[model samples]
Target: MTTRTLTPETSNTFTSTIGGYTVRGRAHSLSAWFVLSLRLMMGWAFAYSGLTKLLAAEPFSAGGYLTHVAAANGNPLAGTFAWMGSTPWFVEFANVAVLWGELFIGLGLLVGAFVRLAAFFGAFMMLMFYFGNWSIEHGVINGDFAYMLVFLAVAAFGAGRILGLDTYIENYEVGGRTLVERYPALEYVLG
Candidate 1:
């Protein structure tokens, strides 16, 4: 492993091997800004999409799309999608979950609160969309897959620590110790 300080206050180092070839590098500190930008962009996209659906005159329904579109897409998960569509309760639940879930995920990311949790759900939703949309005329890689990866990257990098509320939340005092110090498990959810 190679280690080097990229900035006065921080060191970024990474190493990986693929097909017996090892690669190593250090990320510039400026990379944080790009990560922040990605968080904000994805937040806005999901927020806008959910808000539009919530404000529409007609209620959002996923039954038709799930049954007709996804089921007919010749995707690997078409049967699972069809099952979800055929189940009335699951369809109803999905309709509400998709809309509210997007809004909540967006709001969490925008404010940098519970960002890991939000990014997890965001990635899951994107995975579903990726499988559902299954337009592989070019290849299996699509925008949804890419977005899912971005969400995972955000979570893995703990992007919430960059000018986000998670910093404050993590440091909050409960009794005499900081919240994260008191409950280390929170590290999974917060930066």
Candidate 2:
């Protein structure tokens, strides 16, 4: 049998078989799959929740939720939601905003579009949900906290560029300055 020596170029890659399928490529880090899973799961959750609220059989209103929050004695944000519920115009605005926000966040993550922006908003929204009358009796922390961290991670890693539209947008330059150059701070937050 003859053996071949791998050069530097060839050394960069390796092959492995799993479930009888041969996979050949550069090594994949755990973070790659972790981000992908987070994106899909978070995206699906927000999209499904938003769609349900939007297409509910009965007319959906934020007033009821806000009103309930207003009555939640142990919830720190009860007063805030209560005040919001007290204002008809603000209530209407919030109702539309929350539903649309969820839908947009989901779409952004799923399609890997404007992921940084989406994740920023998603983090804050999750924070609001967590503090917005969630019963302390249930637990001090909950799923929203976990989701918030995932959103932050996505933003920090610019995870969208992996398999999303951000990959295309990342290379676009305007007036001799790439988008990242113009918004250097965004480099860490977006691709």
Candidate 3:
């Protein structure tokens, strides 16, 4: 068997190149398109989830979802609301967070408003879901964690600025001009 290694010249930067070609950098159109696609997909996912949870539609019982999470923690809505398995107050809080978080994330992505921030919330909610389920089997495997990982790409890349609301926000004449002009995350996302 032969081994091929992919290495970066400068570890400080997120840039990567190959044989005088920019394997991941300097491609504006490509990057923007990728970000746009991700935003839409993630948005729809959240919207669907929020609608179901908020409406308690068929197959989506807020109570059932809460019970599932609680069960993972070895307790079932029989203990404390805040404690994976107790009070109704905790259940209510989680439901609200999940519902709103999803709706906002979906809407924001579609309109490209605070896209990265919305993605952040989506990721956080996904993490909660992943952890709750994992706890059920004591670190056992679950697929939901993979879905949560999708946001990692969005947040780390911060692609919304590419043909996104950031294009305008980046140039806004606000108190802080440095952040707008620099476009820090551009390097990683662009590459």
Best by lDDT: 1
lDDT of 1 by residue, 1-191 (tens): 37655664446766779999999877787889988988888888988889999999999998987887776778999998999999999999999999999998898889999999999999999999999899998888999999999999889788889889999999999999999989999988885
| Regions of model 1 farther than 4 Å from truth | 1-10, 14-24
Query: Candidate 3 on 116-163: residue-level lDDT in tens?
Result: 677777778777766555454634445556667777677666657655
Rank by TM-score (best first): 1, 2, 3
Q: lDDT scores for all predictions? A: 0.89, 0.80, 0.62
Each candidate's TM vs. the true structure?
0.89, 0.77, 0.63
Who is ahead in lDDT, 1 or 3? Answer: 1
Give model 2's TM-score versus the native structure. Answer: 0.77
- Local error of candidate 2 at residue 39 (angstroms): 1.1
Write down the worst ten-residue block by lDDT for model 3: 76-85
Best by TM-score: 1
User: How much is the lDDT of residue 76 in candidate 2?
Assistant: 67
After TM-score superposition, what is the CA distance of residue 54 in candidate 1 from its true location, in Å? 0.9
List clashing residue pairs in candidate 2.
Answer: none
